[model samples]
Target: MKLPYALAKRFVAGESLDQAVPKVADLNEHGIKVTLDLLGENVKDRKTADDTLQHYIELLEGIHAQNIDSSISIKLTMLGLDIDRDYCRNNLFELLDAAVKFNQFIRIDMEGTDYTQATIDLYKEAFKKYGKHVGIVIQAYLHRTKNDIADLAELGADVRLCKGAYNEPERLALQNMDAIREAYKEYLKVLLDKTVYPRIATHDNKLISWVKEYTQEKGIGKSRFEFQMLYGMRLNTCKALAAEGYNVRVYVPYGTMWFPYFTRRLKERKENIWFVLSTMFQK
Candidate 1:
């Protein structure tokens, strides 16, 4: 059965870029930076991938045109990473070219375990030219991510650290929440120590508190790193953090292809279901 758009609206910005504008503006008005995500993934053909590439070009154009203080995030699968690597790279290059013209930052979003290495390889290639205009995400649950973090640190890459949302086998990812948290702490320390700028992305209250205290003790200034969260999740907390003068950005995805994202999010936790019901008509 198909889910109603209304139910999904609680999480998604809207079904099109035009609809997403006000939401982006509203978040910016509240002093929260926004990162726009076009929201389709795993294209099996060239046409879809090509179309997805154009969408981002236009997104970058719109951001520059409107003078919106927002960045963008793109998933490899959405750009045909599965269909063809060369094709995917070319598509990414086109988007990066546009980002250069518009002076916008593009974040390469990490997907499943299968896409990890390829994603990192592509990001490294892009970083050579785009530099800080391009950023990469690292999931702490993965066994390889610590090593990945070390390598990225060498480049002084800007990195975003998250607990990861994908479900992977025990062979690849940490199955226990405690293990993942411990790994996240270790990853955070490396990121703060080495990366040019680290983005701490999490909704866990304990982790948030720890980061705040740890940074103070270690003498890491607020401008050296920023906190990131998904749009609509922990809004109050995001505001509170921003009010405290820390940079906070929200990942706001808008598109007609929201089913996959919507289902995965609601199924992630029982609390998310009530959370959705509570935000039925919220802006």
Candidate 2:
């Protein structure tokens, strides 16, 4: 089925990099940084996986050639993690190599709990080799995050802290909203104290206020960290924060395979569901 263009516009940038670069330029013009994601994952064959790697290389080249102020995010499964571990590692290294040469950055995006450990492992190996040009994300809702943050912090890794979106059993994640919020607070503090450059990715006003207050109390400079949000969810808030002289980066995802990402964004807020459903019925 075709995705409704009106509904998809709120979350996805477009269906290809050609369509995405202009959007990136617009955001940059607004004084907000960006991370371009080529939306795809879970490939079933080596040929498709190799194609994903080539697309990423071209993406890096595109960013550099266009002089766009943005980084790129990649998923392991899209790069062959499911097909073969060794193949996945090689693919990651290939992207990292290109990123390093282009003087660009790559963010290793987290997936479900099943891929969590392997993703972290891949991040570690890549970081050890590529150094500061790469970063990884940690989900605050997971029970294992504190320890994970501690480990990554010791390596002085660049980390993006976000509340997870995947569905998992309570035994593995914090299910309650309040509990998750509190966990996010604690994780933010740890990231601030330990890591040099942590990206706080959230749309919650409470969390956003807390981050501001905590940074002020700690006397952390605005340049030391960044605030990250999705491409369309909190545009006003992101702009306000950027106006206040805070470094704000938007996660701009684009591509043809957008079902999983679009559905996940809709599930995060009931209003989003109602909006999409209402629009569909009205159409």
Candidate 1 whole-model C-alpha lDDT, 0 to 1: 0.91
RMSD to the hidden true structure, all candidates: 1.5, 1.5
Provide TM-scores for the models. Answer: 0.97, 0.96
lDDT of 1 by residue, 164-246 (tens): 88889999999898899999999999999987689999989989999999999999998889999987689899889999999
Candidate 2 wrong stretches, greater than 4 Å: 277-283
What are the per-model numbers of colliding residue pairs? Answer: 0, 0
- For 136-219, candidate 2 gives per-residue lDDT tens digits of 999999999989988998888899999998998999999998899999989878888888989999999989998899899999
lDDT assessment of candidate 2: 0.91
Q: Write out the backbone clash pairs for model 2.
A: none
Sliding window of 10 residues with minimal summed lDDT for model 1? 274-283
